[model samples]
Target chain A: MPERSLARYPQAVTDWRDFSDDGLTPTLRAARGLFARNGYHATSIRAVAEAAGLSVPGLYHHHRSKQAILGALVDATMDRMLAHTRAAEADSDGTALGRFDNVLECLLRFHMLRRDDAFVASTEMRSMDDTLLLRHIAQRDEQQRMIADIIAQGVADGTFRCGHVDDGARAAASLCVAVAGWYDPTGVLTADEVVARQLDIARRIAGFPPPP
Target chain B: MPERSLARYPQAVTDWRDFSDDGLTPTLRAARGLFARNGYHATSIRAVAEAAGLSVPGLYHHHRSKQAILGALVDATMDRMLAHTRAAEADSDGTALGRFDNVLECLLRFHMLRRDDAFVASTEMRSMDDTLLLRHIAQRDEQQRMIADIIAQGVADGTFRCGHVDDGARAAASLCVAVAGWYDPTGVLTADEVVARQLDIARRIAGFPPPP
Candidate 1:
C-alpha cells in the first residue's frame, strides 16, 4: 500500500499533544466525545449537533449522518496509527529488532496517549457498515502484518527465537492494544514508564535473548 | 474476599458448552443478544421483551430496567470468570508456574468461547452507574490480583525472572482478554490451540527459563 500522509486524512491528528479541540472540526470533536462515552448506537445526530453548538442542518452540511461521523473518526484514527507505525519503521536503524522495538513503542504510545480514539476504534467497529468495516479491517490487517513481518525477519536473522511467529506477533500486538483499555493517565506510572514496561514484555514475548 | 459459587450468581453459567439459550432466562437471553449486538444504550426494554416473546409488563416483572439487565449480564460474566480462575488454580499442581498456565488457559478459553458475554462485559462498563461500576471494578481488580500474585509467587520461588511483576501480570492478563475482540470461531485455530499459544507467550512474558 502507498504511504499516505496525515494531510490526506482530515480527521487524523498528530499525537496526544495534538488531540486538542483545535485539531478537530466542531462536528468531529463533538461526535468523538459522545461516541466514546455514549456509544454510537445510543448517540443521535441531533445530540452531536447540539454538543458541537450547531443546528442539525448545519451539522448535516459537513457530515450527512452519524454513521459518516463515526466512519470519519475511525478512519482518522487508523490513518494516524498507520502513519505512526510506518514512521517508526522508517526511522529505525534498518535492523529487524530495531524496527520491532520502534514500531511496538509507537503502537504502545498511540494506544496509551490517544486512548479515547484507540478505545472507540477498537470497540465501535461493530457499529460500522460493511464497507466501512472492511476498509478499517484492511488497515488493521496491514498493521498486524507489519508486526508479523518484522518478527519473521527477526526469526530468520536469529534475533528472535519464537516458535510460532504469527502467534507471537498476535500476542505482541494484543499486549500493546490492550494498554488502551486499562492505562490510567493520572496513575503513578507515567506513559513513558508504561511503554518501557510493555517493550520489555514484548521483547520477551518475541523470544528475544536476555542481555549477556 | 470470599469465594462465591455459580449458584450464588443467578446469571452465571458454565463454559462455552453451557452458553445455550437453555442456560439463560428468556429475558436475559434476549437482552444479552441485543446488548451484545447493539450496545447497552442503544437497546430498549421493549425490544428485549418483544424478542423474548413477553409483554412490556411481563418483562418488567423479570427485569426492572435496561440498566438492570446490563448489570446482570456484566455481573454474570465476572462471576463466571472468577469461578474459572479459582477452579483453574485449585486444579493446578500446587506450583506457581502450574497455576499460571492453568489460569491463563482458562481465561483465554473463556474470552474466546464466551465472546459475546466477554464483549458485553468489557464494552458496556461505561454505561454502568457508579455503584455497579465499582462492584464490577472490584471483581476485575480481584482477577488482576490473581495473576499478579501468581507471578509474584513465581518470582519469589525463582520459577520466573520477570523484572516487573505487576506490569508482567497486567500484560499477561491483557493479552488473554484481547482474544475476545478478534477470535473467530470458524477460524483455523481451535480454542485449545489459541489457549496453548497464549500460555507459551505468557511463560515467556513471565521470563520462565527455557529447557536447560
Candidate 2:
C-alpha cells in the first residue's frame, strides 16, 4: 500500500534477492521479531531498539517510525512474494486446477518461509489507513481473483467437480489462511518439504492432479 | 495447565449445570474478544473488565488472574473440539481419506463457528507457562496421532496413497489451521455450508479414492 522506502533498502531488490540471504539487516530483523512475537500495537520502539542492541536514535535513523517499520516489513515481504506468486500464475496456462495448484504452492511457501512477514502482512495490515488498506486489499484481491479465475475455468472445462466456483474459491481461500495460524518452524518438516507436499494437497483439494 | 475456574462464572456456572448455555456470560465473552483480537499476553484483565463493564475488583472476584481466563477459554474450546474429532475418529469404517474428511469437517466447523475460541486455543495457548505448554502439546499430539492412525490404516488397506503417513498428518494439521485465518460469518456460505465443502476438499487432498 505505502511506497517502499528505497532509502532503507540498498538499491532495487529484484526477484533474485532473498531477504534471508542479505536483505534484512539487524534493525529489520529485530523489528520483525518483536512485531511477530508481540503485535504491532503492543510493540514499542524501545523494545525494537533493545532487540537490535541499538540506541533509540540508532533505530529511528534507519526507519522513520514504528509504523513505517511495519509498512517496510509488509512491502519487503510482499515484494518478494509478489515475485514468487506471479511466477506461479504465469504457469497457470493448463487446466483450471493447474493454475490453482501453482498459486496454492506459492501461498504455502510464502507463509512457511516468511511466517513473521505473513503475520505482519495479514494481521498488521489492519493498522494501515484507509488508502493503504484499499491498496493492500487490491493486491490481496488480485491474488484471490487469480485463483477464483482458475476455479471458474475448471468448472467451465469440467475438470474440477464442485458445487460452484464461488464455493471452490472459498475453500481454496480458507485453505491458504490456515497455514499462518499453524505453521511450526522447529517441527518435523522443513518449509520447502512442507511446500512440496502441500502443493499436491492443494491441487487435489481443487479436484486436480499434481503438476507433471 | 491452570485448573479451569468455575468461580469466574456465576451460580449457574458454579453448579456445573446449564453451564454450556448460560455459562458463556459477559466474563467469557470479554475474554473471547480480548484474546482473539490481542492474543494472550497483550490481553489484560483491565481491558477485559472495562470491555465487559466490570470493575477490576469484580473481574478478579471471578477469575483470579488473566492467564486463568485464557486457560479456561482454551480448555473449553479444545474440550468440545476434541470430543467432536474423537467421535469422528471412532467412526472409521470407510476409506482412510473418508475418516480424514470427517475429522477435517468437524475441525473447520469448530474453527469457523467458534473463531475466538479457536484463536485462544491455537495461538494464545503459547502464553501459558512451560508446564501448561507441555499439557497442551500433549493434547495436540493426541489429535495428530489419531489422524496419523487413520492415514496408516488407509495405507495398509490400499485405500490412500502418500509418501508417508507423517506427511499426510502434517498436511492435515496445516489444513485445519488455514480455516481460522480466513473464515468470515457474512461470507457466501454458512458455517455448515463451509464445513461440508471443506470436507469434500479434505477428502480429495487425502487421496480419498487412492490413485490407480
Candidate 3:
C-alpha cells in the first residue's frame, strides 16, 4: 500500500489533517464528496481544491488529477468491501449458508456506513478512463464471484436451491448493493434492522427457506 | 394523446419518417441517445441538434430547451412502464401470484427493450429541476406500490411468506430495474431467457416456492 493510504484505515490516524503524519488528505475527502454529489464529470479540480482548502497548485502537489482521486477512492472502497467479505467468511460457522448470510450482512453494513463512496463508485464508472474502470470492475467482479462461488458450493452440497446459481448470486449481490443507493441512516429503520431485513431477502433469493 | 405519439405505437407507422410527418420529430430520438450515452449535463443543445441532423434553430423549433427534451423522455418512459404493468394485470388470470408473475415478466421485457431510455430516466433524475424530479418520482413510487400491494395481498392470502411486504416489494422492484443498467441484448442471453430467469428470481424474492 502507498504511504498515502495509511490515513484511510482511520485507526492509524489521530488527526485527519496530518497528511504527513497520516495520509487521509483533505483533497481526497473533498474529491469523494464532490464526485458523489455532483458527479465525477461535473466536478473540476478547482472545485475539489476549494473544498479541500488548498490552492490548485497545492492540490496537484498531492494528487496528479481528478481521475487519480477517483481511482484511489474506487480502489480503496473495493479493497475494503472484498476484505469485509473475506472476514465474514473467516468468522462464519463453517456452513455455506451461514457463510452466505455473514457475507451479505457484512456487505449491507459496509455499504450503509460508506454510502457516499459507494454511490460514487457505482455511478461514476462511466467517467473513469477505460483502464481504471476495468481495474475497478475486476475488483467488483471478484467480490461477485466470491458470492457466486458460495452459491455454487451450496447447490453442490444441497444447502441451497435456485433456478440458476449465477443468476441467484447476481440477484443476491444486486439486492444488497441497491440498499446503498436508497438507504437513509436517519430513516426509521436502524442499521441493524436494515441489515437483518436485507439478509432475509438475500436468503430468499438464494432459495433458502425462512427460519420457522 | 398527441397525434405525433401515435407513431410511437409502432403499429401505426410503416415508415420511420412518419414521426416527421406527424411532427413527433427526430430531435426527440437524438436527445435520448445523446443523454443516455454522454449523460444529461455533459450533452448540450448544439450536440443534440447536430445528432438530430438539424440546425440549432431547427432543433429549437422542435424543443425550446434541453430540459423539455429530458422531461418528455422521462415522462414517456414512466408512462410506458406503468402502462405495461397495468396491461399485464388486466391480462392476468386474476390470482395474486399469477398477476405478480405477469407484472414481473412484463417489467423485465419492457426494461430490456427500453434499456437506453430507462438508463437516461434513472441517472438523469438529478439533472431535472426539483418539481420535475418529484413528478417523475411519484410515477416511480406508484409502480413500486403496485408490486408492494401485490406482495401484501399474496402474504395476506398465505400465498407468499416474505418477512416484510414493503421491503420485499422494494427489493424485487430494484432487482428488475437494475436489469436495464447492465443487460446486453446482443450477449448470450436472449430477451425471453432474461425475462424467464428474472421471473424465477422474482418468485423467490416474493417468498413463493419454485415451480415443480
Candidate 4:
C-alpha cells in the first residue's frame, strides 16, 4: 500500500460559481435545476423563464434558444471538470500512487459536491448537437486519459498491481462518474463521507490498500 | 479470500424473451427502445403505438396510459433483477465471498445485457408516481442489502476488508448499474471482458483478489 495525500486539486469555477449575477447566471441556474428535475426535452423556455421569474422576452434576451442553454451548461461542465483535473495533474508532485490518489480525490469531490450540475450535464448530454457533443466527449476523454496515465505510471514504478491498467482506469473513472447519478446530499452519508468512500473504492480498483 | 464457485443461478425468462406475440410484448419492446432513445416524457403513447405498428387504442388495449407503460417497465426491471439475485443466493454453495461474487456477476450481466431496460428503468424511474416509485425503491434496497449481507458475512469470517460494508455495497452496486450507461455492444471490449473487469473491481472493493 502507498500513502495517500490530502493536497487539494486547484479548484476551478465551483460548479459555475464564477458566473456573475448578470444576464445569464439566474437563467442558467434555473435551467440546470429544471433539467436536473425534469428531462431536458420536456422543459420548455417558458418553464425556464417561469422558474427564473423572468418574462419570456427577458429570458430570450439572455439565451437565444433553449438549445443554447443546454449547450452552455454541458460545455461549462466539461470545461470546469477538465480544468480541475488538469490543475490537479499540474500541481501534483509525488510518487505515482500519491498523484493518483490526489487526482481521484479531486474528481470524486467535485462530482459529489456538484450533484445537480453533474446530473444535468450527464443526463442531458444527448440533447446537444453532434458538434458540441463531440467537443464535450473529447474533454471527458482527456480527463479519463489523465487518470489512465497516472495508473500507467504507478504500474511502471511497481506502486500498483492491476491486471489491465486501461481497463482499471476506465472502471475507476466510471465508478466516480456514477456517483453523480445517485448521490443524495440529504442522505445519511455526508458529502465528505461519499468522497472518502469513493476514494477507497478507487484504491481497491487500483489493487492497493487504503493509505494509513 | 473466500473461494468463489461456478454454480449457476436460476434464470427468470431472460429480459422479457419468453413473452409471446401478444398484447404487451411488442408494445413493451417499442416502449423500451423509445424510452431508452428519446426519453420517457418526450416519447408519447402515439409514438409508441406507431413504433409497434398499432393504433393508439390498440396500444391502450394492453397499456392503459403512458404512465402505466413507464411503471410496468420500471417494476419489471426491478422484479427481474431481484429475482436473478435471489436465485443466485439460493443456488450458491460456498463461502460468503463466493456468494458475493455470484450475486455481483448476475447483477453486472443483467445491467450489461439489458442495457435498454436498465437505461429506461434508471433514467425514467422519476416518471413513476409516488406509489410505484416507493415500490421500486424498496426492491432496489433489497438488492443492495443482499450485497451488504454478503460483505458482513465476509467481514465476520475475515474474508473481506472495508471501512464500511454498507458503503462498499452501495458503491459496488452503483458501479454495476453504471455499466448500462456506457457499455457498447460494438465496442472494443467484449461483454466478457467488461464483466471480468467489473468483477475484478468488485473483488478489490471487497478487499480481496480475483478468484483463481
Best prediction by DockQ:
1
For residue B37, give model 1's deviation from the true position in Å. 0.9
List, residue by residue over B99-143, the lDDT tens digit for candidate 2. Answer: 777777666666666766666666654478776677677877777
Which lDDT tens digits does candidate 4 get at residues B1-212? 01001011134544332212212256777888888776787889999999989899887777778988777667666767777777777667868877988889889888887877777877776677888888878878899999999988888887788768887898889878878777888999887788888888888887774222
As a whole number from 0 to 100, the lDDT of residue A180 in candidate 2 is: 68
Model 3 over residues B84-174: C-alpha lDDT tens digits? Answer: 6777777778888988997888777767777777778877877899878999989989998999989888888888877688898899888
Clashing pairs in 3: none
lDDT of 3 by residue, A111-175 (tens): 77777777778778878899899998798888889888888878778778865888888888888
Model 1: per-residue Cα lDDT over A1-212, one tens digit each: 01112213544334432333323556776788888898889999999999989899987777767888888778777877787788788878979899999889988887777777888888888899998899999989889899999998988998888889888888888887888888898999887788888998999988887323
Best-first order by lDDT: 1, 3, 4, 2
What lDDT does model 1 reach?
Answer: 0.79
| Top candidate (lDDT) | 1
Stretches off by above 4 angstroms in model 3 are A1-24, A210-212, B1-25, B210-212
lDDT accuracy of residue B163 in candidate 4: 66
Q: True interface contacts reproduced by each model, as a fraction?
A: 0.68, 0.30, 0.43, 0.45
Interface RMSD, per-candidate values to 1 decimal: 3.3, 4.3, 4.3, 5.0
Model 2: colliding residue pairs: A177-B178, A178-B177, A178-B178
Where is model 4 chain A poorest over a 10-residue stretch in terms of lDDT?
A: A1-10
Q: What lDDT would candidate 3 get against the real structure?
A: 0.76
Compute the DockQ of candidate 3: 0.40
Per-residue lDDT, model 4, residue B9, is 19
